[model samples]
Target: MSTAEDREELLADVGDRIRAERHARGWTQAQLGTRCGLSAKVVAHVENGQTSLPLYYLAELCCGLGVTMSALLSDAWVMPTRQREERALTPRQAHILRVAASTGLPLSQVAARVGTTRQVVAARLSESYRLLGVSHLPQDERRAAAARIAEERGLFDAIESYAA
Candidate 1:
């Protein structure tokens, strides 16, 4: 069995991966929350590592994030942040961000992965950007902006390096 410290560390690692994935997609916690049928506060809790990611949401999160569950759980999945005040992530948030940004999968397919209606996915994505401080752009422009953020942060290259 794992010690409490060990468990905390594991949770922290999971949070890190989630945060990394979120940043890779340039999503706020609120955006991820919409995709996963969760609240922003809950999303923040997950990202901050203040609460453990429940097993029940694990699959939903994986589906939403567009990443294999194994990758999220793996130790090799590090995505360190430059924040002076650090945070972690909830599985749901991570999943939503990963799937929406990384997968390039169709909306219906993504919804299928999460066992939800495509309408829900679409609403979540819409609400996500709507909550932003900045004005929303079209999908392609938003994706390009996210890609730029990822590149500036070196998140994609870091993940690739770990994969190699």
Candidate 2:
């Protein structure tokens, strides 16, 4: 295939993945678009592979979909299954952790976004660390460790859909 054809194929694959993830969440294109601060027309064009999305838009889509960029872009990527013995985080905890992981914002800022106190955000993150079995790490490293664990376990992937 020519370079153009290769690009088209890649776009189609990405579009399909996005569509599947969206459908799995039972979200309409408008709903996904709303979450990503985009228009439904943009979502439609993306899903149809009729347009090229900038990296920012793609990142926004991944955030809205609660999936990693790799998962969305890689044909060989598989969603990691949570182990039976692992404790599941509450929806609020998951939300908090997801924000904490992705945004790299201060706990206070994260609290503002989550509509709670910084203390509450800290407590929830503590709980998430425990649940993910990363609390034993040093205090400074706990958050990053927990985030890595969550990402590896696909806790962030499809989290929004599952929480809903």
| Clashing residue pairs in candidate 2 (N, C-alpha, C atoms within 3 angstroms) | none
The C-alpha lDDT values of all candidates are 0.61, 0.84
Candidate 2: tens digits of C-alpha lDDT, residues 106-149? 99999998889999999999889988988888877887888888
Per-candidate clashes, comma-separated: 11, 0
> Where is model 2 more than 4 Å wrong at Cα?
78-164
| lDDT of candidate 1 over 36-55, digit per residue (tens) | 77777876777677797897
Candidate 2 to native Cα RMSD, angstroms = 15.1
Q: For model 1, what is the C-alpha lDDT against the true structure? A: 0.61
